[model samples]
Target chain A: MTTAEITVLNKSGIHARPAALIVQIAGKFSSDIHFARDEDRINAKSILGVIALGASHNTTLTIEADGPDEKEAVAALVEIFQSKFSS
Target chain B: MKVYSLLSLGEKHKENFSFKVLVHGENRNLSHATMNRPGLALTGNFQIFSNNRIQLFGKGETAFLYQEQHNPGLLVNCKKLMQEPVPCWIFTHGLFPPKAIIDLADEMKCPVFSSNLSTSLFAIRSNQILTDEFAPRGVVHGVLVDIFGVGILLTGKSGIGKSETALELIQRGHRLVADDAIEIKSIKGGNILLGAGIRKEVAHFMEIRGLGIINIPHLFGTGAVRESKVIQLIVYLEEWTDTTTFDRLGIERHYKQLLDVTVPFRKIPVRIGRNIAIIVEVAAMNARLDNMGYNATRDLDDTMKRYMEKNK
Candidate 1:
C-alpha cells in the first residue's frame, strides 16, 4: 500500500465536490483506495464514506492505496492535494 | 455555493461576488513584526504591507489592525480612529516605508509591512504572491452536473464516462458546472463549496467515446452550465471486478477529502446498459433527500427491525 498525506486548503475543507473528485480519480485504478482523517477510515471511492469524516480546511488527511496501480494512484492523488485540487 | 463564499476572494473580480474594504497606504520604517501577516479587513478589502521583506494577511473586513512600525502619535490616532478596527497586515520587503505612513498605520490600528522586491515589482508580484498564499485553488477530476437543483460530481476511471454521463445529464435538462478538472474553493464557515472549470482556452472541451470533442457551452447554451457550484454529492464510477464486492443497497455513505470538509458519497459501478447518467442523477436526488432528512437506507433498516419484532 502506498500512503500519502495532504493538507486541506479548501475553505470548506473536504466537502462534496472535492470528495467526489477524489473518489472518481481513485475509481480509475485497480487498487483499493482508502482515506483517513482524524479517526475515520473509508473507501476513497465512496462519496458517503468520505463526507462522513467531516474534514475541514488545513486538516491533514492520509490516503492509502494497495494494488497494481497503488503507486500511481498515491502519486496522482498526492499531486492533486498539493495542487489544492485545482490542477 | 456556500462553501466557496468562505475562501478568500479571487483577484479578477466577478460581479456576482463582491467584497468591500477600507484601504489606506502608508510609507513607514520597517518593523520586524510586520513581515508576513495576511488576512481580511472589517469592510472586506484584503490588506498587505511591503517594507520590502515579507507580506502579511488580514482575513476579513472585520479583522484587527496589524502593524510593523512603533510610532506613538500615530498609535494614539489609530487607537482613537473610531469606527471598526481592521485586522491583518502585509509588509513588503526591500522598499523603505515612510515614517509618516508607519505612524499613520500604527495610529489607524492597521497591520503594516515590507516587501521583498521594489515598489513596482512588489505591486506586480504581490498579487501572485498573495494568491499563492491565500487563494483556494484546489482542483480535481470531476464532472459537475446539476440534477433536480442539486449539484452532483461524478468521478471514476478515465473510460468510466464521467464526462459523457455529465453530457447526458445536461441533455436531460440538468446543468453542467464543470468537466474534466473542476476547480473548487471552500468559503467561510467551511460549508459552501464552489466549483468551476478552467477557462475555455484550457478547458480541453472533452471527447467521449462515439463522440468527438464537443463544446458544451456552445451546444447547451450558457444556461446549461454554471460558472461554479457547491459540490454536494460524489458519485464514484467503477468497472465491476469479479473479486470486488459492490454495494447492493444504497445505505453506506462514502467520503473523500479535498481540503477539510467531508461530503456524502455513493459508489456506482459502471456496467453495460447501466444508464450511468440516470444512476448518477438518482444518486444526486437521493443525496438531496438525505440532506432533507429522508434517508432510504436508514428507513429500510428501521422497517427491517420492525418486521423482526412483529415476527418475533
Candidate 2:
C-alpha cells in the first residue's frame, strides 16, 4: 500500500467541522482511505472514527490507499492539503 | 433578550478570522457542541478564504441573523442590506466568555464560546496539518554497520577511525546504518533504538583507504545492507595498548545512556588487523544471549570457582 502524509492547517484544528469536511471529501473517492495517527489506523470516511482520533491541528496524519485509484486518491488529498482546504 | 428582527444591509464587511478562539471549559459536552455546530448554513454563493473566514457573494435581501450575542455594528450592517435574503452567523470556539471580545460579540449578538486548548497552539497545529509541512524528528549519535541482525554503534573520539572500521564491517557482508551523525528514535517496544538512513548525498558511499567514496549498495545487492537498524549494542573503539584491560569475561553487560533508555555496551581495543568487526558481531551475539538468559562471563566464573573448590 502507498501512503501519503498531510499536516492539518485549519485554524480550528481537525475538530468536528474540518473532520466532517475531510470525511465528505474522502467519501467521494472510490478508493478506500485509511488515516493513521501514530499506530492507530481508522477509516477516513467515517466521521466518528476520524473525530475519535482526537487529531488536533498541525498533527501529521498518514493517509493510505491500497486499491487501484490509490495514486489518484493520494494526489487529490495532497492537493487539498496544499490548498489549505479552501474549497 | 431584545429581539430586533432587523434586515441585513447590502454592503459586506471585511473581517479577518485569523485569531484562534480559546474556550476553556470545565465540562466536555459544552466544549464539543461549541466547535462542531455549523455557524452559517446559508443558501448563497460562498468563497472560503484563509484564516477560516468565508466571504459570501450574492444578491439577497432581508438576511436573518441567528446568534446568541448581539453586536450593534453587525445588526446595523445587516439592517442596511438592500438585497439580503439569507441569515448567517459565524461560528466561534466559546459558549460564553467575560472579556472585551465577548462583550463586543454580545453587543453584536454573535455567539462567544470557550475552547479546551490555547489559541496559539491550536492555530499553529491546524496550519501544520492542513499544509502537510512537518519537520522530521532528529537526534545525535554515531551509527555503525550491522552484523548478522545486530546493529552496532561505534563511539569514541573524532579520529578513532570509527568510519574506517564500519567500512571494514560492511565489506564483511554487513550493513551500514549511519556514519558520523546518526539519528535514532524509540518506536514500538521498550528501549528500541533505530538508526536512521544516511542521506542520499552520502549513502552506501563510504570514505575509506585505498578507495575513496565507494557505494556499497551498488556493489552489493539490497540484502547486503539496511538503511537503518535497531541498535542492539554499542562498541567503544579505544586506542590499542598492552596495558589496556578489555572485558575478559561477559559477566556484567556495560550500558550507555541515550535519550532516556540505556543500551548494552562493549569496549573494543583497536590494533592492526584485529578483525574488530567479528569481535563486535560476537559482542552483539553475547548481548543477545544475555537477553536470552545466557551469561558466558558468569558461567566461566562459576566454572573456575568450582574447579578451585575441588582442588582445595
Candidate 3:
C-alpha cells in the first residue's frame, strides 16, 4: 500500500469533469485507490464517490492505493493534482 | 420474463378491468411495458410503427378508420400493420373495431380488444398494469412506507416491530405502501425499484402483534396508504446487543442488493426508549440530503479538521 498527500490546485477544484478524469485514471491501474479528506474516504475509481468528497481548491486530500502497482497509481494521482488536472 | 397472452390479460383483470375481445388472437403475446396509439400507422405511415407494443385505437384513430373504410389503400395499410407481429389491438370508449380492421386482425392472427373506458382512462390504466407486469420482480419480507416523500423498506426478523414502526409512521402522516411481504419490481432496466403489496386484498393492511390485521387506509383514511412507491432506502432493524457495535458517524454508506440493483442501506439498533419511527424519518430525510450533494458527516469532519488546524 502507498499513500500521498496533495492539495487541490485547480481553480474549479474537483468538479464533475475532473472527478471523471480521476476515475478514468484510477481505472487504468490494477490498484484499489481511495481519496480521503479528513474523516471521509471514498473509492477513487468511482466517479460518484470522488464527487461526493466535495473537495474544493486548496483542500488537502490523501490518496491511498493498494496493489502491485500502488506506487504508480499514487504517483499518477499526485501528478494530476499538482498539474491542476490539465492533462 | 415471458410475454403474457391476451387471454391472460382478460382473465387477470376480470373483476375490475373489462376488455371485450373483438378478434380471437388469444395466443398472441404482450411483452412490452408501453402501449402505442397507432395514429400514424393507421394512415399508412409504417416508418415509425412499433410492432411489439399493444396498439390502442382511440376515438380519433377509430374515427379515421371509419371514414377511410372504402379506401382500398386503407385496407392495404391495415393488412400491412397486422402483418407485423403486434401484441394486440385495443379500442377505447366502447368503440367497435371496424369490420375491415377486424377481418385483417383475424386473418393475421392478431387479437383485438375493446374497453368501455375513455381513451385517456384506458391508456392510464393499461400503462400501469403493463408496467407492473413487465417489471423485474423480487419478493422481500419487509414493511414499506413512504416517509417525507421517500420510500423506506423496513426489514428485520419477524416480530421485530417492523409493522409497528410502519403504523406509527402512518399515524405521523407518512403513508404505508406494504407490510409483511413486499413485491419489489425493478423498472426502466433496473434503474428504479418500486415496492407494492404481494396481494391486492392485503394491500395497506398491517398485522400488529397484539392488534391483528388492521386496514391502514380504512383507519387513517386514504392518505395513509400508497398503491406503490419507488424504494429509495432500506433500514434493517436489529436488536441492540451488548457486544454489537453500531455506526456512530454516518460517513460510510452501505447498500443492499435487490433484483440486481443496489439500494442505499442502513442498520438501526432496536432498543427500548428509542423512537425508531422518528429515527427512520430522519434517516430518510438525511438520505435525501445526501442525494442532493450535502453530506452532514463529511461537512462536520471538515469543520473539525479546520478547527484543529487553526488551534495547532
The most accurate candidate by DockQ is: 1
Higher-lDDT candidate of 1 and 3 = 3
On residues B1-312, what C-alpha lDDT tens digit does candidate 2 reach at each position?
111121111011111233323322121111010111122332222334121221121112112233313543543433222112222222223222235433444444432223233444434443333222121233443546777787888877444677677776777778876565455665443356667643433445554434544566787767666777778788888888888787765566688877555788788888887877677777777767877898776788899999999999
lDDT of 1 at B163: 75
CAPRI docking class of candidate 1: incorrect
Ranking by lDDT: 3, 1, 2
lDDT of 1 at B159: 63
| Worst-scoring 10-residue span by lDDT in model 3 chain A | A39-48
Q: lDDT: which candidate is best?
A: 3
Return whichever of 1 and 2 wins on TM-score. Answer: 1
DockQ for candidate 3, C-alpha atoms = 0.01
True contacts kept of each: 0.00, 0.00, 0.00
TM-score of every candidate relative to the true structure: 0.51, 0.44, 0.58
Query: What 10-residue stretch in candidate 3 chain B is worst by lDDT?
Result: B204-213
iRMSD per prediction, in order: 11.6, 18.2, 17.0
lDDT of 1 by residue, B1-312 (tens): 011111232223322222222234332222221233223222233344222323333222112333324434433433333223222244333333346545555566544433344434444554443343343446566677778888777888656778778888888988887666566765543465666664434243554656545767788787777776778887888997788798787676688666676776777878888898888877877777888889887898999999999999
lDDT of 3 by residue, B210-282 (tens): 6645778889999888888999999999999999999998898999889888999999999999999999999
Model 1 CA lDDT for position B82: 23
Worst 10 residues of 2 chain B by lDDT: B28-37
